[model samples]
Structure formats: structure tokens, C-alpha cells
Target: MRLRVDLLPHGQYPDVVLVIDVLRATTTAVTYLERGADALLLTATPEVALALRGGEDGSPYLLGGERGGLPIPGFDFGNSPVEATGQNFTGRTVVMNTTNGTGAAHTAAQTGKHIFLAALTNAHAAARRARATATEEIAIVCAGTDGQVGLEDVYAAGVLAEYLLAMGEFTVDDGARIALTVRRNSGNPLEALSSSGHGQHLGRLGLGEDVRFAAGLSTSTLVPALTLDGDPPEGTLRFTAG
Candidate 1:
């Protein structure tokens, strides 16, 4: 199988794109939706996120987003998986815009035949999905920060690549090989992310807990995949009761 990994959201080309933004956005989105949020409304701009929160959908939606590791002004919550998972968002919708994650989701939707959201928190499930999709080529697209590669996303991609490669004998491309090699070189994802560029910045901004949460592996069964319209059909994925 040919597996590719892209470091940025733009200029994408792939058959199946697995969007990764480990230190918070993607992690938090998956966590929130898993916790019971009706659905996640993704937006790339802060203005759009805020505006949506007050429009008709706002009543059942909670505004959540961040800018440079800090919660946006007046938002109900910032992009933190730890905090997001704690709530019982039974029938609520999360209106979210982040520095990376959501945009990556949108970008992947443009070219991927089967797009998925992957992170250290759900690597095994993602690998399972990849194996089942029966696709010969897959792309792990990272929601890089400000056009530069992000350590958290890349590290998570590396983890996923390693897991998928270990699932069975499958041909991997140089990018997949490199990602697997990096995952091995990192020793431990949490420690590696702690020293990462964006990770360090998040720590400085008092989001160390969020970083730790995002660094965890298989902590959730909430496999957030992108499909036309909204989330996938019922029973397509099963999650633990929140």
C-alpha cells in the first residue's frame, strides 16, 4: 500500500487523508463529539465560529475555539480535549474553529475518497479503519501551524503510520517509512510533544494538561471520520457510553 503524509492543509493530493492535529484541535473535536455533542460544526475562521454561535444554531451549540494556544475572547471553551471530554454534551453541537484541526478536515474532504481524523488518542482504531477500507494508498495530512510543520501532528502521524504498518505486511512509501522512523525515534510521544514548537508554546500558555490529554493513545473509541453532509451513518462506528 502507498501511504503518504502531508505536513500542511493546502496543496493537498491523496486518496484517503487522515487529518492530524494532535495537540488539541483534532483531539478535542473527536473527544467532544464522542462525549455526546450532537455534531461538530467546523469553521476555519474565528469570525465564522463566533458568528455561528449566535445564529439560530447557537442555542444548542457552544462556541469553542482558540488563537495561538489561548481561548478566543468570549468563547465558552478553548480547544482542550481534557476539558471538552468532561462534559455531557448529549444534544449539544460544538461550533469550533481552531488554529489547525478543522481546516485540515475540510482540506482532506476535497480530495480524499475516505477521509478520517487520526491522532495518538485513537491510532489503533484509525489503523483498523485503514486496513478495512481496502485502499492501496492513504495520506496522513497534518494541520500544521502557520504554514510550518507541527511536532504534535507529525508525531501523531508517525504513531499512526507505525501502527498501520504493524497491522500486516503492506508496502509503505518513503513518507510512511519516515513517519514510522520518527515515531520510533521519539521514544515517547508525550515527552517529544512537550518539547515540540507548538507544544512548548501551549505549555507556556497554561495548556500543558491539554497537551498531555492529546498525547494519550487509545483513550477514546470515538473515531471521528468525515463524510458528506455531516458525520458517518449510525452504527458505522461504536463508542463507549459517555
Candidate 2:
């Protein structure tokens, strides 16, 4: 198997791709699944997220996400893992539209066949799952902030690369090597994450709890696998909790 890493969806058609957004997006998603939400659907933008469901029949679906790290005006959740962990979303679906995370996932959907959401929270679970797949290639796509790379995402990418490389079957490129080095040299996960631009951005918004929640290393045993529930162009990815 071959391994590759890129920022903000470079598209490699790997059998599996881990979409990392450690600042909060994917962390919130994994929390949603672990907290008992049935499925999490990703959308490129807030408008598309709203377009997926509207009017009187929007019941059983929760509107969640953020713009620029702040809660959207009408969203029920704002990409915060701490908030997600505190709520009870049993038997519901979360429709998400985040600034960068979901957008990166949407871009990855175009090429990756089996996409998984990865964060420090579920890094080990995701890594092990990807390793077991033994796919021809595995791609680590970092959801960079505002069209540029973010330090936290790269750090999470490094954590993921460590486990994938440990599987002893894949070859790593320089991008993957850099990520691994970043994680290896990162002194403390919480400190590194808290000092990141997006982390501080969220902290200023009083979402410091979310940053702390996302910083927990390998705290979960869940791996969220994306599955298409309908046709393309209008298809929604159902985050399968396993």
C-alpha cells in the first residue's frame, strides 16, 4: 500500500482518506457519533446545508456548524466537541457546514472512495481501520484554515501518520514525513493545539472547552466512516459509527 498526505484536499483517489480538522470540525463530528447521534452529513457551505432540508419537515435533523469559528446564527451546534458531548442527539441526524472542515471533506469526496473523519480524538481508531483495509493507497487530507495550511491540522496529520506508518505496509512521501515529524516534536498536544491560530480563535469565542476536548489524544474508540445514502449531486454522506 502507498501513503500520501496533502492539505485541503489535493485528490489522490486513495481507497481510504482521513480528513483531519483538529481545531474542531471533525472532532465535533466524532463526538456526535460517540454521543449517540445516528448520522452526520457534510455540506460545502451553510447555504447548501440549509438547502438539504427546509420548511416544516426538517424535524429529526439538527442544524450544526460554524463560520470563521463562530456559531452560525441559526445553527444548533457550532462545531464544538464539548457542546456536542454535552447534548443528547439520539436517533437524530446532524447536517453540518463548517468553514473549512466540511468543505475539505466535500472536496475529498470527489476522489476518495471510503472517507473517514480523523482527529486526535479518534486518531488511533481511524489509523487502525485504514491499516486493516490494506488499500492500494491511503491519503491524509488536512483541512487547512481559510485556504491555507494550519499548524493544528498538520499536527493531527502527524499523529495519524505515526499509526499508519506503524502498520508496516505502506510507503510515506515527504508530506507524510513532515507530519510525522511535527507530531513527534510537538511537546504537548494541548499546548500545541491551544497555541494554534484556529485554536486561539475558538478560545477567544469562549469555546476553549472545544479546543481542550479536541486535544485529547486517542480518547475514543470510534471511527466514523462516510457512506453515501443517495445519488450523486444530491447525495449526503452518512457518518457510520462503528
Cα lDDT computed for each candidate against the true fold: 0.75, 0.84
| Collision count for each candidate, in order | 0, 0
lDDT, candidate 2, 1-242, per-residue tens: 88888956775565888899888889989999888988888876687667666665647779898888888986777888888888998988898888898888887888788888999999999999888864588899999899998889999999888888777867888889888888888777898798888888888988888888899999998988887653423645667685
Off by over 4 Å in 2: 230-235
Q: Tens digit of lDDT per residue, candidate 1, span 1-242?
A: 77777767765554667778888877887888788887777775777766655656437668788888788897899988888877888887777777777777777776677777777888888778876784667788888887798777777888887777778777666666667777778769788789789988988888899888887888776667654454532222212211
Worst 10 residues of 1 by lDDT: 233-242
Using lDDT as the measure, the top candidate is: 2
- TM for every model, in the order presented, reads 0.88, 0.94
